[model samples]
Every structure is written in structure tokens, then in C-alpha cells.
Target: MDLHYSPFDFAIQKDPYPVYKRMREEAPVYRNEEDDFYALSRHADVVAALKDSERYSSKNGLRLEPAFWGPQAEQIFSFVALDPPRHTRLRALVQSAFTNKRVQALEPRIREIGKAHLEPLLSGDTFDLMHFAGGFPTDVISELVGVPEADRAKVRDLGMAIMYREPDGGPVKDLPPSAMAAVGALVGYYTELTIDRAKVRQDDLLSGLLDAAEGEDRLTPEEVVSILILLVGAGIETTMLLLGNAWHAAAAHPDQKALALGGRIEDWVEETLRYDPPSQTIARTTVADVEVHGTVIPAESRILLMTGAANHDPAVFENPDAFVLGRDTAGSLAFGYGRHHCLGAILGRLEARIALEALTAHIADYEIDEANAVRIGSSNNRGFASLPTSFTAR
Candidate 1:
């Protein structure tokens, strides 16, 4: 069999671990001529590239699609696409608002929101877990961003539209017109929200972002809108997918699922992240000619740091395929590494933990209707779009 890998390939996207394993052993520095990108599948190489931002630059956003890659990438990805200095400054200012205190304080509210959403879905018969998975995080983020209750559904729909694509397409090379429209709509909506918040300051993240100052500097209106837009995908979509993946994985492994349901929510979150993460591939551009495993990847070349492949490398994880709870996942790149590490990670985990805790409090067990489960088609993300699940209530 010939060695071939492309993130755009639907078959590969559906279950990439097999191909990732092959790439790790056969070609650590794998190249796909069809997509015009190089991929690093080995754990060591992916981690090294993630850490050495100087060589593996993130200036071209995190995905290789034509619409997302380039100097203007930050408009969509915000500070995530920027290299140091600029990244450092903006992150600092944003952090002043997205403080630990702010996130930690949301636990009570997260529980409240969790109960509000989870209670209705526990009607006994099969219900799509995605209904809960998708709505919970959006409401949480909307609450944080000061979005009115009426507007949250619209926000979630827009976010879902942006993250969705047909999993059986030719090649998801770029965002379709519908997704582009969703982006424009979200931007316009946030622009109005930010402007309104500016007029009347509220105790929300948006207001905090507007006032987040380093010395005399503060985030401008445009910057705040960009950050909010970034949150629609980062803060909401990622967490939403993580919850769905956790639920689906637990259903697949009953023993591990029992442990998770038996007050090991933290372990559940951590293992799910390592075993099958939402973020599968993150792309970067080579700043200089880089030689890895005898292959010289030229400067300015697009490269993908295959985090999904790295997580399953036996060299790093013992019995990497098993869904083991409480295993050591020390060097996992599930949330990325170094400069580009996900800022919303803490909030993401917190939301998952609380949401699951709420679920376990009510349900004894749940079963996923895998035959009808629909996986969201994305180049970098991997998770369910519609997971019809039946629950056994406690």
C-alpha cells in the first residue's frame, strides 16, 4: 500500500488515527502533494515544532485553507495567528479581562446553566447528545460575552454553520459561501453587541475586554469584535465538541464509562482529550529550510502538526489505543503548546467537568446510537454533529 495523507480527504478525516500511525512509523515527515502541505506525525517532531515557534511560525493561522491562511488570518483567528511580540501584547491585554478569577467565578453559573439545559433533555428516550453538547457551551459563552438570551440560539447556529461541512465531499479545501456568510453575520452581530456594551458597561467578558488595559492601552472596538469572533469558534465550538467526544468515547467503553460516572470526571476529561481530541491537526508555515528524518522542508512551506497522531504514538503513550482512565497524559498537545496554547482551555475543561457532573447526578448510564451518529466534517476538528443517545436515569 502506498503512503498517502491529506487532511481534506473525508475518509481520512472520519478516522485519521490509522493513517496517523502509518505516518508515524513509515514517514514521520510526510508530504501530501495533493494538498501541498507537509505533516509531522511523530510525537517528538510535533512537540518540537509546536515549541519552536521561531521555525514553525503560526502567522498563517492554524488551518491550510486558502481563505484562512495568510497575513490577514488574524481577522478570523485573532491573536492565535500572530507571532510573538504582537501576540504577547494582545494576549496580555486580553488576559487582563479573561482573568482566572473571571473564569473560576463561572462555576456556579455553569452549574446553573448546565441544570437548565440538561434537565429537559433527560426525558428518558433517545435524544441527540449533540443538542445538549452544542447548546451548553454556546449559552455559557453567550452569558460570559453578555449576549441576551434571545440572541444565543442565533449565535450557536452561526458557530455551528461555521464549523460544519459535508464529510463526504471532494476536498474541504476552503470555507464555502455559507460559512463565509455565517462569519460575516457573526462579526456584524458582535460589532453591534460590543458597541452596545461600550455604551452601557456590564459585568461581562465583553465589557471587561473593552476595559482591559495595559498601562494606557486598551482593546479597540475592532480588536474586541475580532476576539469575540475568535471565541465563537475557540471558546464555544471546541468545548462543545470536547463534550460530545467525551460522551461518545465513554459510551464505547463501559468500564471506563463506569469510572467516569463514578466521580472521576477530571480523569474523564483528561483521557478523552488524549485519546480522541477535538483538535486533530494544526497547520504552521516553515520560516526556514527544516530538515527532519532526512527530509528538507523548504522555507515558507505549509506544515501540519498532527496532534491527533502524536497523542496515539506508542513511544509516548503505553497502549495508546486503549481508553484508559487516569493514565499519565503529561506531554499531550491536545490544547497545543507554548505560545499558541489555547487560552480558553481552563474554561473548556471546567465546562466539561461541570456538565458531566450534572449528567452523572441524573443518569445512571447512556448508550449512543452509533448507526445514526453524524460526524462533523472539518479539516482540523473531529467530533459528532448528531449523537442520538438513550439514557438510564438514576
Candidate 2:
């Protein structure tokens, strides 16, 4: 009956598929006492829960922890955490920015940015990929969102703080006063930017959102600011993890590295996403009583969808543990499925592909400095906090 996993389990953090497999087979709808929540570990059950938003609402909040900033933060976070109707409306206002055409149009610019950032790092014999290569996408997204080049650093810092919480599932308390001050300053800066964009029309996504939201179901200024926050926070960190994971994969499999640098770079990116997703899990709350894999979940029970586990489910994928490039994992839930699927998935993929291509083309070889590299100690996200790698410039 006690099938809960501790968030601090280093072994599980490193490789959780085995434990997930056991959960899926033995207790797909197991409840944990530590977090006081139910979990859906199997591929089929997680997919059904994600798609059945009507039955599993997100209004209570997406995170495992309770909200601290009151209803405003709750409402803003609800964009991802809410069920349909309201979620559909809010999502529509900004969907254009992530359209296939728009992301395709940005591909060239993203490539250029990747090269520019990677070039400087290649000069050094060793560098932290998390800071240099992994961080480049943050600047790229910032620029695309109309953030001034000078303030990109501030945005990055705030994003890191917001996305990563402490091991106790609480807000980071160790941040210096200066860090909090920076967060306050950035929030005010974004507020002003939203106001400015509202007044003057521009060709950016913010302007487009302002124009589009003028009439029916119009988003308030606060909503716009919150959307911006979500966009930057989600966009930067996930992409950073993708890049770092790719480097880690390549270093582990020399053959895959050659294939990636050669003709199958994109496939490698997809495989990495499947093998080691940035978002390890997503949470949902049951709106009504539901039975998953014969286990009953009571109404209002929190359900954790282990995306990382589902991606490795043997029932859906053959040789799930192997990181085979170009494998047909059509049903892979790496991006999540159904309503709350990642809005920027295409853009994230393109960024990772371009970054990998540039690195493999310019660098001769690389190895992960496991001793120095730091794994981010969080349950929700799986990624390196600092990935130190030594590479030879080609």
C-alpha cells in the first residue's frame, strides 16, 4: 500500500524507470503518505488522465505544493493548471506565437544564435554547458519575446528561481536579498512592458496578443504579464535541459554522437527527449471519482503523471531502456498529450536540433565531468544544474 517515492532519492532521480515499472505493474494508482497524493504510473492511465481534463481538473493548482501568493498567482498558474473552456480561451490568445509556421520562421535565427553562443565556449578547453550552450536558448526566447538584451540576465535568474523549488517542496529560501530584489524589479519591468505594448502596436507577439485580446474574452494586463512569465520560465529551462541531456547522451554513446553529428541529428534529439525528459512529471486533480486500472481515485485527489515513466513503458515502446535514434516512439508522452501538451514543443525541438548540430560540427569530442556536474535536486524536473564538459574545438 505504501508505494510512494521520496523526492530526495538520488538513485530514482538518476534512473527512475525501474521503479516506475514496478509501480505500473503493481500499483498504477498508488497513493503516497509523504505527499498525500495518488499517482498514475502506467502509460495508458497517465494519458487518459491528461486527456480527461473534465474529470481531472487543474483549478486546484498544478504543483504538488500549495500556492503562497494568493489568488492572482493561482489564476495565472491556472492557464496550465485549469480545465477546458477557460484554458481554451486563454491558450488561444497566444497560440499564434507557437504556430508551426511561426516557429519554422524562427529556425534560421535560432541557428545563428546557437552558433554565436557556442563559438565562444569552444575556444576554452572546458566549459559549463549549462551556462553557455544550455543558456543560449534563454537569450533566444527573450529576444523573440521582445525583452531587451540587457535585461535577459535578470529574466534568466528569476526564471531559475521560480522553476526550481527546494527539496521540501517549498520556495527557495537561501536566495540572497539581492535575488529577491531582482525578481521584484523584473516583475515591475514586465508590468511596464505589458502597459507599453498595450499603448503602441508593434510586430512582436506581445503586440499581437494585445490586439487579439481586445474583444471577446480579452486577457487583462495581469494575465498578459503572467503569460509572459510562463512563456520565458517554461521555454528557457526546458530547452536548457534538452540541450544538456543531448550532450550527456552523446558523451555516453559515442556511436550515437557520430550519428547525431552526421545525418540523424534531429532523431537524436527526439530520442533524448524520450529517454530523459526535462519535465519528469505533471500533476492533476481529479474533478470526480474515477477508476484507473481498476484502482479507484476519489474526487479531488491529486494525481501525479510520471511522464518520464510513461516514456519508458515497455508496453508502448520496444527496448524502452535503449536510446535508439530514429526509433518510432509515436505514442511517447515526452511532450505530454491532450489538452495541456507543451505549446512550444516545436520551437524547443528546433532549438535543441540546431544547438546539437552546431556543437557536433564545431567540436571534435566531449565528455561529461561527472564529478563537477551538478544534478538539479528536484522531483518534477530532470536536468543538470551545471553540466561541465571538456571539448576539443574542430
Candidate 3:
């Protein structure tokens, strides 16, 4: 049997685990000449690649799609797409805005937002979990960024517009016209929002970013807008998907679901991250030739650190395929490593934990209508856009 893989293929995206298992066993350094990239499937290799930013650089952005890869990626990905010095400086400025005190401050508000969205759907009939999964995070992020209540829906719609892809339209090698338009609209919207906040100032993350400084250096207007856009992608979208993945994974395993709903929600979140991470693959560009498992990838080549595969690698995880809670998920790369590690990770986890806690408080048990569920099509993420569920109220 031949080994063939392409992240852009929708079929592969739907169920890449089987293929990932094969890649780990047969070709640890799997190559897809057609798509022009190499992949690392083992846990150690992916971790190594993520840590070795000098050789496996993030300068070209963390995605392989044509529109998102290259010098312009920074406009969308912010510090996530940059390497040291520049990455270090921008990350520090962004970090100041997300201080421990500030994130702890958002917990009460996050719980309120989660309950507001989840309470209305507790009637015990069939409802789509994605509604709460998507809306809760959107509202949380919008509130944190100080987007007015009136404009949050518009902002969420714009953020979601860029995530859709044609599942059967072959591999999406470039962003579609709709997605490109949405990107432009988001940039324009945030740019204006920054200008507005600059004048009137507010008690929000956007305001914090504006005030964040390193000695005498501070973020410029364009830089502030860039970080806001990054939040939409990193903070809201990924967190939304992570929650949905957790809901779906729990339903798939009744035993684990019982434990999760029985006050083990934190373990549920951790295991779900290790089992079915939302952000599956992270792309990087090679600055120098690298050899792994007897294969040499030349400099200037595109490479994918198969985060999803690494999480399931038998070497790192015991009984890697099972969806069991309470496992030590300390090494999971659901969030990457090194300097480019996801800045929104702490917030993402908090949102999921609170959202699920709210959910289990109202629902006694739930079952998924998997036949009608729809997974989002994207090269870098793996999660549902719609998860129809039936539950029993507590």
C-alpha cells in the first residue's frame, strides 16, 4: 500500500487519524510531492520541529494555503507567524495585555456568558451543540475585546466567513473569493475599532493592547489591529472548535461521558484536547536541510508538524486511540511549543472548562446525531461546524 496524504483534502480532514497512524509506522518523514510538503508524524519529531524554530521557521505563516503563506501572513497571524526577536518583542507586548490578573478577572464573566447561551438550550430536545459552542466563545472574545453587544454578531459572522471551504471542490489551494473578502472586511473593521478605542478608551483587551508597553516602545495602530484580528482567529475560532470537539468526543464514549458529567469536567477538557485537538496540523518552512528517520528534507521546503498525529502516537500516549479521561495530557501539542506557542491557550482552556461545566450542570446525558453532524473543512483545524445533539435534562 502506498502512503498518500494532503491536509487540504476534505476526506482526509474528516478522518486523518487512520492515515496518521500509517505515516507514523511506515513513513515517519512522509512526503507529498504533489502538494510540495513534508510531514512529521511521531511525537518526538513534531516537538523537536516546533522547538527548533531556527531551522523549521514560522516566517511564512503557519499554514500551507497559497493566500495565507508568505510574507503577508503576519497581517493575519501576527506574532504567531513570526520568528524570534520580532516574535519575541510582539509577543511580549501582547502578553502584557493578557496578564494573569486580567485573565482571572474574566472567569466570572466567562461563566456568565456560557450560562446565558447554554440555559436557553436546556429543554432536553434535539439541539445543535455548535450553537452554544460557537456563540459562547464569540461572545466571550467579543466582550473581552470590547466589541459592543450590537456588533458582536456581525463580528462573529465575519470571522466565520473565512473558515468555510468547499469539501468536494478538490483541495483548496488558495482562499476563495468569499474568504478573501471577509479578510479584508475584518482588517478594515478592526482598524476602525482601534481608532475608535484610541480616542475614547475602554476597559477591554483592545484598550490593554493599546496601553501595553516595553520601556519606551509600544504597539502602533496597525500593530494593535493586527493583534485584534489574530484574536478572532486564535482566541474565538479555535476555542469554539475545541468545545465542540469535547462535546462530540464525550458523547462517543459513554463511560467517559459519565465521568465528565459527574464532576470530572476538567479531565474531560484535557483528554479531549489530547484525543481530538481542534487545531490538528501546524505548518512551518524549513530554513536548513533536516534529516529525520533517515530522510533529508532540503532547506526552503514546506513542512507540517502533525500535531494530531503526535497526540495519538503510541510512544507518547498509552492506549493512544482510546478516548479516556484523567490521562496526563501535559505533553499534548494541542497548543504548539517554543516561542510561537499559542498566546490564547490559557483563555481557550478556561472557556472550554467553564462552558462544559455549565453544560453538565443542566444536562443529565446526551447523544449525538452524528449522521447529520457536519465537520468544518480546513487544512489546519479539525472540528465540527454543526453538532446535532439530544440530551436529558438534569
Among the numbered candidates, top lDDT falls to: 1
Model 2 clash pairs are none
TM-score per candidate, in order? 0.98, 0.91, 0.98
Instruction: Write candidate 3's Cα lDDT for 1-394 as tens digits.
Output: 7778998888888889999999999999999999999999999999999999889999999889888999999999888888988989999999999776788799999999988898887765778999998889889989899998998889989988887656557777888899899989989988888889999888899999999999999999988888888887788888888989999998889999999999898899899999999998899999999989988999999999999999999898999999989998888999888777787888888898898889888888989998899888888988998899988888
Better of 1 and 2 by TM-score: 1
Model 3, poorest ten-residue lDDT window?
163-172
Cα lDDT for residue 262, model 1? 92
Which digits, one per residue and each the tens of the lDDT, describe model 2 over residues 1-394?
A: 4454744455567667778878887877778865678888778888888888888877765556444122344443637755677788878877844467867877787888787787777776998888765568887877677777787777777767655533323333233456456556666878998888778866666776676552566777777777776775468878888888878877788888777767588888889999888888877777789987677888978778888888988889899888888899687787889878888888888888888778778777778898787776565777887888887777
Q: Could you tell which candidate, 1 or 2, scores higher by lDDT?
A: 1
Worst 10 residues of 2 by lDDT: 166-175
Model 3 whole-model lDDT (C-alpha atoms) = 0.89
* TM-score, cand. 1: 0.98
Residue 44, candidate 1: C-alpha displacement in angstroms: 1.3
lDDT of 1 by residue, 71-155 (tens): 8889999988888888899999998899889999988999999899988887766678888888899899999889999998899
Error of 2 at 187 (Å): 3.0
lDDT of 1: 0.90
Residue-level lDDT for 340 in candidate 1 = 79
